[model samples]
Structures are given as structure tokens and as C-alpha cells.
Target chain A: MRVPVLIRRPPEILSSEITDEGLFLNRRKFVQAAAAVGAAGVAGSLLRPKGVRAAEPGQDEDKLTPYEDVTSYNNFYEFGTGKGDPVKNAHTLRPRPWTIRVEGEVGKPTTFDIDDIWSRFPPEERVYRLRCVEAWSMVIPWFGFPLADLLTAVEPTSAARFVEFKTLHDTEQMPGQRRGVLPWPYIEGLRMDEAMHPLTILSLGVYGKVLPNQNGAPIRLVVPWKYGFKSIKSIVSIELTREQPRNTWMVQAPNEYGFYANVNPEVDHPRWSQKRERRLGELFKRATLPFNGYADQVASLYAGMDLTRHY
Target chain B: MNQVQWVRRVLKPAVFVAAAVPFGLLVKDIFGGTLGANPVEEITHRTGFWTLTMLTITLGVTPIRKVLRLNALIRLRRMLGVYAFFYAFLHFTMYALDRAVFSGLGLTVGAIVEDVAERPFVTVGFTAFVLLVPLAITSTKGWVKRLGGKRWQRLHRLVYVAAIGGVFHFLWLVKADIRRPVIFGAILTVLLGYRVGVWWVGKGRRQRAGHVVAAGASS
Candidate 1:
């Protein structure tokens, strides 16, 4: 039987120098295409650090079509508002040949290239239950290993109680960012322990297809247990810090969106009824499930706290 | 009306088809499988949009008639109001089905009653729609002749209430931006303002005429 669930695509980039494992190392096409993209990125970003253009040939390019199933979809207000606007507007993003600046409260301060970071963590295919803050959900098969692997590489000290991530902000490309409609350079965070959770994966791609421009090309954090907004898209920086980082939703409406946005049917959004959610594609009326039906795995994360209060 | 009446006669069918195209296309789409995986949201958004559009059109009739000096265009007002309710019915269908999980299969009445009681936005919107049903049923020339112009005018004033309700419905659903709702509010305001302004001006003219007649009789 074909399971009605989401499947993630493989990354366009893999290591050119194959590791001894040779597991995905045999996938050479992914590597060469990545190099071509990286070289272009270096030439472009070096040319104009604050520049944008119609998605260059290998800058996570795809032809515009009116109708197609969205491989990556989210309505996270912080990552530029609008449902379909992200990918259409994020064309000027310089994703490849990039660097993730990891700092603060960590034993080692390490800045790694995109290729090196991919090698540091072994990639895995995980089918996660995705719940949106709006209450609807989908099951996505994602590619990438545990975020815990990234934590281990950085070696966060005990004082490193939170992990905050940031997205690149260019007013030209991300017009929504230019507007004060939302705080720019969308920020998201997790308690150090939550960041280290096994289910938390730094997702690279979906549907066995490379990251679509709309879906946060290159890399994004996918925290399946929490609401979709908790998972930031198109990540640029990851820092281990003691202080909590400013999150986008909370800044917009503190009462409605809490820092810990878990998928609990009991806790409804302030403006609308949360008791029921309209599942995407269900037409009009479909009942919502609790914990997005992942209660078995993630229920332990919020065992003691009053979710209604935090929510 | 020599020229104006001819235009109205020509536009009658065109107007009817234009108003009906949405319901027809929606029904055809359901069968054609053009609606994506989430068809209910698709249908609801489409229906709701038309409901608002029709309401706006109904409100626009008087303004257009006044501005263009085409008083006969006012005849289109009733048909437009009826179409607003018709599209509203489709929007209600999609919302009901999408929220069916809240009410189990075949138990829609209870669910409907319960949801309206709990959700005030839906409650007000549905109430506005329910009131329009009677006016729609009584829109015939026979009913108008029986009720007389005064009574007919009074009964049909519910369109104002329905317009207010429609604006509120748009206001409640949208979360992020307030721009769309504000635009609808401004349009409704102007439509209502025009009616009051015209009535005040007409009333003053009649009072002045009565004073003139009384003075002339005394002389």
C-alpha cells in the first residue's frame, strides 16, 4: 500500500572526496552539480555581498509553473509572510559556498563550509509528522541526520542552554523582510536539550528532490514535534548560547505564539478555534489529531510544564 | 430611460450569466478534478471571495447610478444582492464540510447550532445570511406589488445589515494584515453614507416646499 506521507529529496551537494564508507559517496552527480553551484556563488557573493538577481542558472533554479504540488510549504510569518511568496521571492539568496557561523558558550568555535558540515553528519531518511501552528498537518520524509550530530561536532558546554538559528536577510529579494511587517533575518531557537533531541533534523531536501527555492534551499531546521513555525527555513547561522534568542512569532504576537509551539489540539490559537483544523486537501471538514499523532514519541518533552500557559 | 431602458434590457441576461459563472465554474471544477489535494479550502476560498465580490457589486450599483447619471442601473441592485446570498450558500457549504469533523456525519444540525453558539464571528455571518433568505424569496414583482413600495423598501433594507455582516466576516478570518478588511469597511461606509446624505437633502427640500405653500395661501 502506498502510504500518504511526505518524502524528502536528496541534497544536490555531496563530498567530492569520497569517505571510506562510500555510502552516498557513489552519488557523484550530486557532487559535481554542487561544485558548479558553489563556484558561481563565490563569484557572485564576492562581486556583491549585498546583491540579488533572477535565480542564476545553478542558484537553486527551477522554471516557474502555475500548477504543481509544493514540495516545501509553510506559512511561517518570520520567513517572509505569504504562503507561496517565499520561493518566488527568495531567488536572490546566496545559499551555496556559504558558511554557518557557530559561536557562543560552545567549547570550540568552529566555522565550517557547507561541504564539510555535510560530511560531519551522516545523512538519514526520516518520515516526520509535520504540524503547522494553524493546526493542519502532513507527514514528511526528510533527508538529513539528527541535529544532535551537529551539536556533538560543536561540543556545547553546560552553560550552552539554548541553540538559536538565523536566516539570511536581503531586502531586495525578501521584500517582506524589508517591511516592518515582521522582524527581519527571521530568528528561531530551542532549549539546548530540545536542539539535541533525536527527532530534530537539520533537513537538507525533500521528495528525493533537491531543496526547492520555495522550500528553503540548501538547509533548514525541521523540528517535527513542534509547530511548523518552530522549524526555521533557509538557515544561515547556528549559535550555542546561554540566553534565549528572539523568535519571530513571539515578537509578532507574544500571547498567540509561544516559544515552545508544540502540536497540542487542546491549546488553540487565540484568534481562532483550535479544537478543529482543516487538513490541507481535505476540502472542507476534517477532524484534527492530537500531538499530530506523534504523542508516542514527543509527549515526554513537555511532561511537567503547563502547555496551555506556554502556548 | 429611452436610452437607459434599452441598455438595461440588453444587460439583463449578461448580468445574470456574469453573476452565475462562479457557481457554474465551481460545480464544473469539482467534477473536473482541477481542485488540488485540499479542495475544500479551494472551494471555500473561491466561494467566500465571490460572496464578498457580489456584496461589493450590490453596494456599487447606487454609486454607479448616481455618478454616471444612469438611474436605470439601480434595477440591477436586487439581482446582485440575491447573487451575494447564493455565493454565501456555497461558502457555508465548504466551511461546514471542512469542519465536519467537529460534527459527526449526519449530525450537521447539532454541529451547526453548536458552532454558531461558540464562534461569534460565524454566528453573526450566518445570521446575516439567514435574514437574506426571506428577502430573496420575496424578490418577485408579484410580492413587490402586494407589499406596496413602502413596505418593500423597508423589507429590502436588510441588504445593509448583510453588507455589515459581510465586512465583519472578512475582518474575523484574516489574521496577519488588516488592509483588506479596512478596504471593505471603507466601501461599506461610503455606500451607507450616500443613502443618508441623499435622504437628508430630499427631506430638506420637501420641508421648504411646504413652508412656501403655507405662506402663499395666507397672502
Candidate 2:
């Protein structure tokens, strides 16, 4: 019998969405043309930092805040204080041809170009919940690698107890720096354990695109579990110190901000509550999770210490 | 209608719409996807700013009438005060939504309660809104009649206290760049200064009148 022969199709290996690819490519061209015309003399290649494709099943599922919102609404006081000011002002910031000096307690004490660092640490997609002390949150799809990789490469000495980060201090570019706003060239620090945490990353982009100037272009730190300020932006230097370094916020307002700055719902800021946070896209405020919902990964680091007292 | 009657009939309503334009524009912006990236924060800030603006304008009415002898301006004071309360109410409700009440869904009463009780900025702002409630309720002619003029005046004096509270609430909440709040502080000071100037001038005139009458009676 030539009758009923079963015909089954092979399982599909890849599924790609059929959209207007031409339009996407055209828009990218437009962006390149605009960047080329800008006064900052930013080359197209330098304007967009190409990163390795992060593996699929990425945090794309974690309800991202709109790219517009992520770029427009920022708290980069280096640009200005207003929520919208950074987007308007940070356009002047030239992030290309950047170099970061890694000194203090490191054996190499190297000064590496931003491109070199990017090569060393291939990008990975990390969707992290960024909670600001101001009680607002955003789910950012950060393209970066574990800071541990960089720390490992640098080879921190045994005496290295803390890692201090410093941002670039160019008054002409960073207008807010001209004004004495919290002592310019903002500084942030982390303990050795916190620095090595896999969750801690050095971010170059967000939402699979090169980070916009206001979102801290080129490179910035992303300590997901800690308060957003702890993730200092537009990093220029990394120093390993023996003592706990003086963080900018803590030095400015010790009573309000602390060294650890771990996202603790229990430890309320002096002026505002930390119990709840308003996620950017949401209308209602949700209860803030301990360690920004990374408690499982980072809580172990703070085992014996009292977070409340430290905060 | 006569000029006086026409002004009474038409001008007040125009001012009412003018005062409410900010709120209407805000609502339209919210729906039109133009309230910027952080819509909740945009809403909160716009409403809060309008509330303060309305309160400042309401406080300026008496001074404007007395200094410029534009007695007709006094007619707009109650409307201004009511508008201030309307914006203040929106400001308060938006705060609940912006800060503690909403996430992606709707209201969370637990977070709201915790914020009202625990956060100093929220506590001060909530208190200021609560204090405005009585003044807003008594704004109507019926309520004013029920309270009686002297008692009503005494009750309404609480607006100054509420204004002070509002300024303090703003001062406490801002992280840095207190320039805007300080400017508002200056405006509030000037408004209070006018009231003090009037009171001092009135006190001097009354004391002089008393002295002249006493001297005339002795003579």
C-alpha cells in the first residue's frame, strides 16, 4: 500500500521577524550622518561602539523602560540637576578617544584606552533593576561584562581593600562641573568583595545600542544591587585602595547617603522612604525588593555586617 | 449689560479658565504622549508647581487691591484660592501615585500609608494638603456664612500657615539646586512683607488718630 504515508516537517532552527529592515538601516545611516555633522568631531565608527551579540534568552523579557525614557530621564548630576537637563546638556560630552587609568594597589598600574578595555571584556547583556535613592527604578538592558574580568586582568594586590571610581572632570564639556555641585569629578567606591561580584559590571551600552551621552557614553559602572548612585557614570579612573574611599554622595551628605548604599527597604533615607519604588513605566509604586531583588546573589556578601548601621 | 455688570458676568469666568489652562494642558499632554519620558514625575511637578503658583497669586490679591486701589480684583481672590486647592488636591493625589501608590498597575494602600507616616517630605506635604482641606471647604459663600465673618476670617488665616508649610515641603524635598525653591521662598517673603507693611501702617495711623482725639478732648 501506497496509502497514507506520514509527512512531518523538520523542526525550525531559527525564527526571524519579517519587518522593514530597509527602514532600520536608513535610520542608522541618518544617525551616522547627524553624528558626523556634530561639532564634537565624533567619527561614525567612534560614535557607535560595536559590541558582541549577547546570547539569546536575554533579559529582553524584563519589561524595559522605553529607550526614550532611559536616555531622556537621567540623574547624571555631572550634566545638571534637572531630570531633563542631562539629555540637553550632555550632548557636548565627547566620550571617544577616552582612556582610563587603573592605579593604586594594582601590580600593573596601567592606563588603557576605552577600546582596549572593550576588547578585553566582550559585552554580555545584563538586564538589571536600577533603583535610585530618590525611590525611582528602571529595568535597563545593560551590555557589559562582569567587572571581575577587568579586576582579574588588572591584578589587585593583597592590600587592595576597596575600589574607587572617578569620572572625567572637564568643565567645558560638563557644565555642571563649573558650578560647585557636590565637588566635581564625582567619586564612588566599593569593597573588594562587592567589586568582584559577578553582578557588578562595567557597562558600555543599553537596550543593545551604544549608550547615549546622557546615559554615560563609552563606559560606566553598573552595580545592580546597590543604589543607582553607587553605579557611577562616565568613569575615567579606577583605583584600588587599602581604606574605604570617600564616595561623593557620602562626603556631601553623610547623614543621607552611606558607604554601602545597598538597596535596603528597611533602611530609609533621611528624607525619603525606601520601602517602595516607582518603576518608570508603571503608574503605581511597588514594594522595593531587598538588594533590588538581587538579594539571592548579593545578600551573602553582607553576611555579618549590619546594613542598617552601615546605611 | 452695563460695564460693571458685564465685567462681573464675563471677566471672572475668563480668569477661571485662564487659571485652569495649566491643568487642562497637562491632561492633554498626558493623553497626547507629550508629558516627556517620566510622565508620572512630569504630572507631579506640573501640578505641584501650579498649586504653589495659584497659592501665591491668591495671597497677592489683598495687596493688589489695597496698594493699587483696584477693589474689583478682590472678587477674584476666592476663585483663585479654590483653584489653588484644586491643583493642590491633584498634586497630593499625583504624589501618592508617583511615589508610593502605583507601580505598573494601580494603588497600593500599604505603601501609601508607610510613606505618609515615615517619609518626612511626604509627611510635610500631606500635612500641607490636609490643612488646605478646611480652607477649601469653607471657600464657598454658604460655608462662609455658616462660620460667620470673624470666625471665617480666623479660619481662613490658616492659608498663610498652609503656604508656609507648602514652601517648607518643597524646600525639604529638593535634592540640590534649591534655586527654584529659594525663588519661591522670596515670593512668599514678599507676599508676607506686604501683609506686614499694611498691618504696621494701619497700626501707626490708628495710634496717631487716638493721640489726636485725646489731645482734642483735653483742650
Candidate 2's C-alpha runs over 4 A off are A1-61, B1-14, B96-114, B143-151
Best candidate, DockQ: 2
- Could you report the Cα RMSD, in angstroms, for every candidate shown? 11.0, 10.8
Task: Report per-candidate DockQ.
Answer: 0.11, 0.31
Best by TM-score: 2
lDDT of 2: 0.78
Q: What TM-score is obtained for chain B in each of the predicted models?
A: 0.87, 0.89
lDDT of each: 0.68, 0.78
Q: For model 1 chain A, where is the 10-residue window of minimal lDDT?
A: A38-47
lDDT tens readout by residue for model 1, A1-311? 11212222334346343232233323323542544422111111111222332221121221111113345344644345545456556666666877778888888888877677676664655656566776555545456667888888878898999999998776664566656766778899998878887778887655444456566767889887788888888787899988988798798789788888877778877656565554443222234455665566667878898989977
Tens digit of per-residue lDDT, candidate 2, span A3-76: 11111111221112211335533543454355442121211121132232222212222355656778899999
In terms of lDDT, the poorest run of 10 residues in model 2 chain A is A1-10
How would you encode candidate 2's per-residue C-alpha lDDT over B5-32 as one tens digit per residue?
A: 6557887889899998998898788767
Residue B215, model 1: Cα distance from true site in angstroms: 7.1
**Model 1 regions more than 4 Å off:** A1-73, A76-94, A178-180, A276-289, B101-108, B203-219
Find the 10 residues in a row with the least total lDDT in model 2 chain B.
B99-108
